[model samples]
Target: MKKRYILENSKSLLVLLVLFFSSCVFAQQNNTTPIMENQFWKNVQFGGGLGLGFGSGYTDISVAPSAIYNFNEYVALGIGAQYKYLKQKDYYASHLYGGSLIALLNPIREIQLSAELEQLRVNVNLEGSNSNSLDYWNTGLFVGAGYRSGSATIGARYNVLNDKNGIYGSAFMPFVRVYF
Candidate 1:
C-alpha cells in the first residue's frame, strides 16, 4: 500500500517539477541583486520551522530542515524534509514524515509568491484493546503570498488538497520563515 502511494505520487511530483522549472525559465527578468560568483554560499539559503507544545493534555512537535537556491531574483527553488509528532493522552499518537519542493517568485522587493508540493506518510495509532497502525500518503499542494525582508518571511498558504487528517491540519496555514 505504501509503495503504491509512493509510486503514484512520484509521477505527480515529477510532472509538477517539470512544469515549475519551465515557468521559471520563462519568467521576465528585472533589475535585481547580482549573484556573487566567488561565494556559492551567498546564493543558498537554509531554514524551516520548529513547532512545540507541552501541557498535560496533549503534545505536538515538528521540525523541518530546508534549503533554497536563488537561480535569479525572480525565481528560487527549494527542498525540505519534515517530521512531526502529536500525542493526546490516553487517546492516540500520530507521526508524519515528508519531503517538500518549493518555488518562490519575487516580482518586487518585499513581496513573494510561493508554491509548494509535499509528499508525506502519516502513521496513526489509537490506544485501545486492538491497537493498530494505519499508514498512508498525505500529499499537499500549497499556494500563497508572503512578505519577505532580509532573512525573515511571513506568509499564509492554502492547501488545495486539504484533508482533515493531512499534515497541514487545515485549509489555511500561517508561516514564519528565516533563511541563513
Candidate 2:
C-alpha cells in the first residue's frame, strides 16, 4: 500500500514538472525579444511560514519554505517543502515532512485564488505501556481564495481530498501568505 502511494505521488509530481517546464518553454519561444536566462530568476519570489508553540506537556514546531516564479502580474507557480514536530509529554510524538506544488491566480488586485497539491509523510511513536509506531503518507488537494495586498494574502482553503484520519485533522485551513 505504501509503495503504491509513493509511486502514485511520484507520477503526479512528474506530470506537474513536465507541464511547468513546457509552459516555460512555450513562453520563451513566443517572446520576440531575447530574454537572458538569469532574468528568469529575477521574477522568482521566495517565502514561507514558520511556527512554534510549547506549553505544559505539549509542543509543536513547524517550518515551511517556498519559492514561486511570477509568469506575469496575474499568474504564479510555486513549490514548497515543510517539516513539523509535535509531542505530548506522556502520549505520542510525531514528525511530518512534506512538499507541495501550488498555483496562484490574481483575478484582480484584491482577490487571489489558489490550487495546491500536497503530500506528506507522517511518522508517529507511541509512548508508555502499549507502545507502538506507525508510518504513512497523506495527500491533500486544496482550493482557496484570499484577499491580497502588496505581497501578502490572507485566505482560507478547503482540502477536496481531505480524510478524517489524515495529518491536518480538518478539511478547512486558514492562511497568511507572503512572497518577496
Candidate 3:
C-alpha cells in the first residue's frame, strides 16, 4: 500500500512539473504599468479552478474562487474559497468546503513559488442514512511550486500536516487554474 501510494504521488508530481515547464515557454513579458501606478484595481487578479465529473456510477462537482493582489511582477498575496460535492451510486456522498490565504513569488515570468494556509470541513454520509453523518475540520499549511503564463497555471502541493482521512484525501494534490 505504501509503495502504491508513493508511486501515485510521484506520477502526480511529474505531470504537474511537466505542465509548469511547458507553460513557461510562453510566459508573458509585459512589465509596464506607468499609467496605473499603484492602482489597486489595476493590480488585482481573479481566478480559480472549476471541476465537473460524471462517470458510469458517480458524479463530482467543485468550484474554487480566488483573488490576488500583485505587489509587483515578483510577488502576490491572495485568498480563496472552495466547495465540492461527490456522490456515488448506492454507496456514499460527501461535501468539502474550505478557504485559504496564499502567498506567491515569481522569480521569473514562468516559475512561481506558492505557500498557503488552509481550513476545510469534510462531511460524509452513507446513501439513505441522513441520521448518521460524519464531519470534521482540517487545517494545514501547504507549500508548492508551479508554472504560470498569461491566464493559466499548473501546480502541485504536499500538505505539511496531513491526515489519512483528511479532506484532501492525501498529502499530494495537483491543480489546474485559470484567471480572468
Candidate 4:
C-alpha cells in the first residue's frame, strides 16, 4: 500500500512540472524600453520666433528662442529667451532682454492653449538736449489659444498684466509657433 501511494504522488508531481514549463514557454514577451530609459530626449522639442518692423523713423527687431519638453500628448512645459531692440529716430532707443516660463495644453489634436510668464529687463536711452537713461524690470502674464496644424500653430494672446508703461504697445498680440 505504501508503494502505491508513492507512485501516485510521483505521477501528480510530474504532471504539475510539465504544465508549469509549458505555460512559461507559451507566455508573451515584452521587449520595449520605458519612457525614462531611452525616450527622454526624443520627447523634447525646440522652436521660437523672429520679428521685425520698420517705418520712417521707427524700428523694431526681436528674436525669441524656446524649448519645451512634452510630458505627453496633452501637456508641455518650456522656457524661452527674448531680445528686442526698438528705436525711434532722434527720440529714444530701448533694448529689452528677458526670459519666460510657459505651459501648454492640448485637449485635442487641433487646438492648443498656453500661458506664459515673462520677465524683461528694459534699458531706455533718450536722445536730445536733456538726454536721460532709465533701467527697469517688467513682468507680463499672457494667456492664449490657437489652431494647430502639423508643426505650426497660429494664435493670439492677451497680457493680463499689461501696463501703460510696459514694453509691449498693447495687451493683445498675435503669434505663430512651430515645433520640431
Candidate 5:
C-alpha cells in the first residue's frame, strides 16, 4: 500500500510540472509586442482636454473631447465635441456647443499634425433683463501639432472662431490628453 501511494502521488506531481512548463512557454509566445503590421485598420484611441480662452471682454473655459478610429499608420479621422461656458461681469451668460472633424497626419513615430474644422452655436441671455434669448451660428478653424506616446499626447493649436455679436476669439491653446 505504501509503494502504491508513492507512485500515484509522483504521477500527479509530474503531470503538474508538465502543465506549468507548457503554460510558461505559451505565455512567452503571447507577450504583448507593439503592433507594427501595416494594416488597413488598427485599434482606435480616444481622449480629450480642457482649455481656457481670454480676449476682448470674454473669459471662457471649454471642455473638448475626441475619439479617433485609426484606419492605418499614416491617416485617421475623428469626431470631437466641445462645450464652453463664458462669464463677463454681467453683460451676458453664454453657452456654446460645437463639434469638429479632425484629420491626422503622422510624420514619425512620436509626432503628428492635425487639422480641424468646427461649427459652434452660441446662445446668449442677458442678466436681469426679460429679453428674448439670442442665438447665432459660428464656425472655427483649428490647426495643430502634437506629440504622443503609449497613452498620452500633448499638443499646441491655433484656432479662429468667427467674429459674431458675442462669441468670437482667436487663441493659442496648449493641451494634454490621456487615454485608457
Candidate 6:
C-alpha cells in the first residue's frame, strides 16, 4: 500500500510540475499577468485559520498559519505550517511542522490553483510508548483549488506524503483564508 501510494503521488506531482512550468513559460512569452487586476498581496501576504482535519487517527481541531509572496501577478510563492491535535477515542496525538517554496496559479479572476512540495517532522506518542517517543521526517506534495472574493478565500486540498517509517498517507483537507 505504501509503495502504491508513493507511485501515485509521484505521478500526480509530475503532472502538476509539468502544468506549472508550462504555464510559467507561456506567461513569460505573453509578457502579462493572466488577470487584468487583482487585490493580491503586493509581493507578500499573511493568512491563518482554524479548522478540523481527520486522518490516521481521528478528527481533531487544527490551526494553520501561512504566508504567500507573489513573484508576479500570475505566480505566487508560499511558505506555511500546520499544527494539528488528533483526538483519538482513547488517546491524543499532535504534530508541528512547516513548509517552504510552494506555488500558486491564478490565471483568471475569482479562481486559483496551487501545488507544493514540503518537508515535515512528526512525533507520535501511543499509549504504550509514552515514555519512548518516535520521531520521523516526511516529504509531501499537495494540490488545491479555491475561490477568492474580497478578503475571504476558501479552498480544498489533497495531500500525499511519504513517511520516514515507510508509510504513506493520502489526505483530503479543506481550508479558508482571510486577508487583511
Against the true structure, what is every candidate's RMSD? 6.4, 3.8, 11.7, 22.9, 21.4, 8.3
lDDT of 2: 0.88
In order of lDDT, best first, we have: 2, 4, 1, 3, 5, 6
Q: Clashing residue pairs in candidate 5, if any?
A: none
> Candidates' lDDT values, in order?
0.83, 0.88, 0.78, 0.84, 0.70, 0.66
Once fitted onto the true fold, the runs of candidate 4 whose alpha carbons sit more than 4 angstroms away are: 1-38, 129-131
Q: After superposition, how far is residue 103 of candidate 2 from its true place, in Å?
A: 0.3
What's the TM-score of each model vs. the native?
0.79, 0.85, 0.73, 0.78, 0.60, 0.60
Alpha carbon lDDT at 83, candidate 1 = 96
For lDDT, candidate 1 versus 2, the one ahead is 2
The model with the greater TM-score, 1 or 2, is: 2
Worst 10 residues of 2 by lDDT: 29-38
RMSD of 3: 11.7
| Model 4 clashing residue pairs (backbone) | none
Say what the RMSD of model 1 is. Answer: 6.4
Off by over 4 Å in 3: 1-38, 128-131
Question: Relative to the unseen true structure, what is the Cα RMSD of model 4?
Answer: 22.9
User: Candidate 6's error at 151, in angstroms?
Assistant: 3.3
Model 1: per-residue lDDT, tens digit, 55-101? 89899999999999997888988889999999998888999998988
lDDT of 6 by residue, 85-146 (tens): 65565564656464534678878768878887755566766565546556665556678889
The clash numbers for all candidates, in the given order, read: 0, 0, 0, 0, 0, 0
Task: Please tell me which predicted candidate would have the highest lDDT against the true structure.
Answer: 2
Which is the leading candidate under TM-score? Answer: 2
Higher-ranked by lDDT: 1 or 4:
4
lDDT of 1: 0.83
